[model samples]
Target chain A: MIENVCLGQYIPGSSILHRLDPRIKILSFVIFMIISFMSGNIFSMSILILSVAVIILLSGVPLKVYFQSTKYILFLIFLSCVFNVFYDYGEAVFKFWVLTVTLESIKNSVIIILRVTSLMFVSSSVMFTTSHSNISFAIETFMKPLSIFKINAQDIATMITISLKFVPIIFEETNKIINAQRSRGADLDNKNIIKKVKSYIPIIFPLFFLSFKRASDLAVAMESRCYNNIIKRTSIREFKISILDISCLIYIIVILIGVVYCEYLMI
Target chain B: MSALDIKNLSYIYNQGTDLEKIAVNNVNLSINDGEIIGIIGHTGSGKSTFAQMLSGTVKPTAGKIFLYGKDIWKDYKNRKEVYFKVGLVFQYPEKQLFAQTVYEDIAFGPKNQGFSEGETEEKVFEALDFVNIDKKLLNRSPFELSGGEKRRVAIAGIFAMNPGVLILDEPTSGLDPISREKIINNILSYHSKKRGAVIFISHFMEETARISDRVAIMDRGKIKMVDTPENVFYDYKSLKSINLDAPQITKIVSNIHSKGYNINKKIVTVEKGTQEILRLLRE
Candidate 1:
């Protein structure tokens, strides 16, 4: 059941998006996220959404996987849409008791849904195309300027890489603990809220203990290998921006311009 | 009726995905009450997956699992009852320990079984005794225990459930020889006392041959053979073809028999092998 979580999971492929440099992918993701949120009207939002769709197609990752990742946040999207529909700023198109549905409110909710979905699809696309180590490498390169301020970019990168690596491992450990408890008659599907919450005690406690134990073991292993965070480490694979990366960046820039023009038109 | 009957049992992992794998495939077996069945397989032979299905922790993709003539998956609402009837001690079960104290950890299963408070305590003590754990450590945190002790405590937690079919996956892996012997003895005593069907999954041929009434060999998600230990180990060549070895005693006796020494090749345990050799020397 935990296998359905696609967040931060990388799918290997030889697609155009996969070939792009990690730094370029990370930069594009941030830019896309910002522009998607800044989108004010349907035209601007549609432009961003169209670009995301194109990116997803180039990613070579199945559309079902992206949908699975967004499924986890569907409730949040629905909640925000409901709140937008009830906001008292617009002229009411219909009234049922205390609830008010307005023309502008409906339009705002549609924009909100589109904005959130496009943001999720863009992030998932980036994650699917870029490996975790590449992400850490990209982050380290990006954070290199902070080294002048006495911050260790390599250490931060290592921390991020380790945590990212543990996401799947922790999921596997939780699955094992859940099966063990279930074999011993844990009613994890109990209908009562209190009982259901209490049933997770077996799963949560063991998972936390196992994770801590694993972390300590990892520390000891690193110490034994003479790993010193103070020493500067060189990466084996150096990031080089290829023609594909530059073109992708140009494409994103064009999409940003189109979205800005649409926003201006809306104003 | 057989205590545990599996018919065409199958399990597929990640079905329909590119990573799809047939973990257990079209297997059939019947384990009688009060019987001990040993399952030996190489890593990824689907032994663990098959054990999980037998305990109803994992539902098979296609097939039926019957616990004493009742289909475990027939009634979804009462499927939880199968957990009480079939207890599974996972590989390296020590990681399953969670409660604050050893007592509480063992009691968790019986309590979940809806046993009364007094019955839960009694069952916990009985489980501790079955696993040969010290009662003085009842109040101590399970995390503070040694590796072997933690493993024992974890097994005791499952034992407290008093399941009719106990499935243990590699229970003695990574343990000292003495602890391994103690665990085997505890399992034997538990089976004798409870008269429940025991399915022991392991990579160790000697221990499996020593305790099992019948041994089942699995290769690539299929059960290659199931027979008495003596008969199973007697055919060492077939076992070797599947990347498995008979117990050392069986191999030695078979080697002696091949040398025209008139020794019995079906010897599986060390004691029986010794007895056969001694008789030959007397002759």
Candidate 2:
């Protein structure tokens, strides 16, 4: 429901981090996430968390505004922690009426929460600062290395970007349908689970129809613009790996290596 | 007493959120049985929000809506019953049709209201006939019909319920002239035959002036004027203030009146305008 509310949600800022090439930010983001997973103990998790915090600070976006994005997923994060705390079988540190909290369990819970939070915050920073069009271009460029594996990177990137684009469009269409149905006395909010599922038919029916129609229109528009599907489609300007981009990439690589070595020590 | 009465109704969107907006301010209106009212307002003037409140699609943020002198939100049971009594056809509702065949789609509302199999079929066919769609097209997939035909079928879906108050939002929008005439004529005919109250929102002033018993001018979430079509049109000053104008012929007739000639300022149609001008010129 929240996602259906508006478009052009990116917050604008003039920080140097906002000016960094989206391609480097994307690569560094992925590298950091992977390093977060590799991080085992509290110390290593702190390092990963610190990296995400630094990126968030550099983005110059209001910290509270950036964290508000995680509110929707807080339920899932809590569920994970609660499940881990109870189900993890280890040396008990505290016991209460047939329930036991163990040292290993608490540590595992903290690691997972920190890992997920770090991933969410870092990726959000990228989305907050980078425009969607630039992200699409960066994704297309980064996938070029996948050509060695005999994959069409452009096709993959285009598909990803198109799917991402449709998410918001579909959300908007669904909200309109919901409002329309409600105006007709279709009470969706005060219904049981089974009834709720049935109520979705009206909203879903129109949305499916509109999405196909939109896809067809988009295809025709793309063709009219002389879109060539094959043979290394040209860009008006090519991306050059600048000094800032290289330094950011190097720093991300060093962090990944350091985290892996720390995990080795923990084991 | 009015068949439907809204007293001091107000609504706010995203009420508790930082982005909260007052879509419909405190306003009161009423509709009696067998009255056809046209509500006209520009986009975001809260006309649509008002329509939603009337049909019980939304509970007002404040105030009470009465149907037959009883509060609509008195209880959950009464609220459910009120929906069938006040049918709402959204703009381009045709796209909401999803049944495999046209008949089932048209019968959706009546069936949802718990009509028996034979009765539902009878009502669905009656609605289709009322909307003037060809009987031959009843068995076809709704998706296969032309846009205007699909729109009619969608309307027939709501008509099958045979509600006491029918509300339509921009029913003739995006249709050819002939199709527009057909839909508007169908609505007028339905109103005459059923004798039910009808509230419709439209931007086409000429068409609305022709069919509506009364016109309600809304500006910035407030109903500026509610009068018979002639009276509403005659008030050109207020209409101009709201960036709306009377029908083209009405404006010409009013201009003639301004030139110290004897003419009815209430004249709306082009034919009446011509006759009145000729009569004045003869003198």
Candidate 3:
């Protein structure tokens, strides 16, 4: 059940999105998110969704994976839509005791669902195309100017990369621990809330201990190899911008302008 | 009825995804009560997945698993009961220990089985005796114990439940020779006292050969053969074909037999090999 989550997980491929500059991908993801929020009418929203779909196809990652990443957030989106349907004040399409379904509310709910879903797909598409190390490196490059404010970009990047690497490892460890506990007759499926929480104690303690041991061992391994923060790090894979990246950026800017214009016309 | 019966059992991981893999495939086997079955296979030959399926930890993607002629997954509510009946001791089980003390850890299983306080304690002590753990160490934290001791405590945790069939997956790997022997002995003693079926999975051919009543060879997610040690070891060619080797003694005996020696080629244990070679020399 835990393995189904594909959010922030990179799928290795050689597609155009995979080969694009990580900086440009991150920048485009942010811009896409802004455009999705600004997209209000059906025309702009459909345009945003269509472009995201195209980018997802270009990413060479399966559409199922992106859907899986967004599946967990579907409940949140549904809740917000339900709230908008009941709470919004406008023309009543249907009336009931203490409740009314308004045409405006229906429009708001549709826009909310489309906006949130498009945002989720865009983010998951970006993550599926970019590896964790590349993402961290891009962040480091973006934060390099912060060094003037007494910040260490490389250290922050190393931390992010290590944490991202640990996510999968820790997930595997948790699964092992859960299986082990289950084998020992731990009733993890108890319906009683208190009992269920208590069952996790066995799993949590071992996971915490294992994570600490791993972190300390990793630190020792790095130190043994003469790792020092005082020295600047050099990466083997250097980021270089290409014409494809520039074209992709320009395409995103055009989309941003179109979305803003549509929102202005709607207002 | 057999203690455990698996028919056309198969498990596919990540089904419908590109990462899909057939971990266990259309496997069939039956283990009798009071039997010791050794399963040997390569690293990715689906041995662990097969073991998990038998112990009811993993649900089979296809086919059925029967515990004493009853389908285990027939009713979801009874799954926990099945788990208690078929205990699994995973590789490096010591990592599973999380109780405040060794006693508490061993008692966890029996307590889960809903035994009373007195019965839980008795079962815990019995498990300790079976695994040869000292009573004095029961009060000590499981984390404070040495590697071998921690392993024994973890095994004892399973034994306290007194499962009808104990399935151990590579239980002795990464341990010293002495520790390995001790664990094997503990398992043997537990089987003798409980008279329960045992499914032992291991890379060490000699240990499996020494303990198993019938050996099952697995390859590519299928059971290639299930036969006695004598027959399985005698046919070394088939075992090697699946990237598995017979016990060292069996190999040496076969080598000696190939050199025109009149000794039996099916010797699987050191003691039996020595006796056969001594008999050949005297003749």
Candidate 3 lDDT, B174-204, residue by residue in tens: 8999999999999999999998899999988
User: What are the lDDT figures for the candidates, one per model?
Assistant: 0.90, 0.81, 0.89
Chain A accuracy as TM-score for every candidate: 0.95, 0.86, 0.93
Sorted by TM-score, highest first, which candidate order results?
1, 3, 2
Which structure is stronger by TM-score: 2 or 3?
A: 3
DockQ of 1: 0.63
Candidate 1 clashing pairs?
none
Enumerate residue pairs that collide in model 2. none
Over A1-267, each residue of candidate 2 has an lDDT whose tens digit, in order, gives 232232324556678677888888888887887898888876677778777777888888767665566766755897889878876487989888878889888888877887887787787788778766677788888778898998887877777778766876777567667866654445577559988888778778778888999899988998899766576877665767789788888878877877887778556
Runs of candidate 1 exceeding 4 Å displacement: A1-3, A265-267
Interface RMSD of each: 2.5, 3.7, 2.5
List native contact recovery per candidate, as a fraction of 1: 0.76, 0.35, 0.65
Q: What docking tier does model 1 reach?
A: medium
C-alpha TM-scores of all predictions: 0.97, 0.85, 0.95
Give the per-residue lDDT of model 1 (tens digit) for B132-177.
Answer: 9999999999999998899999999989999998999999999999
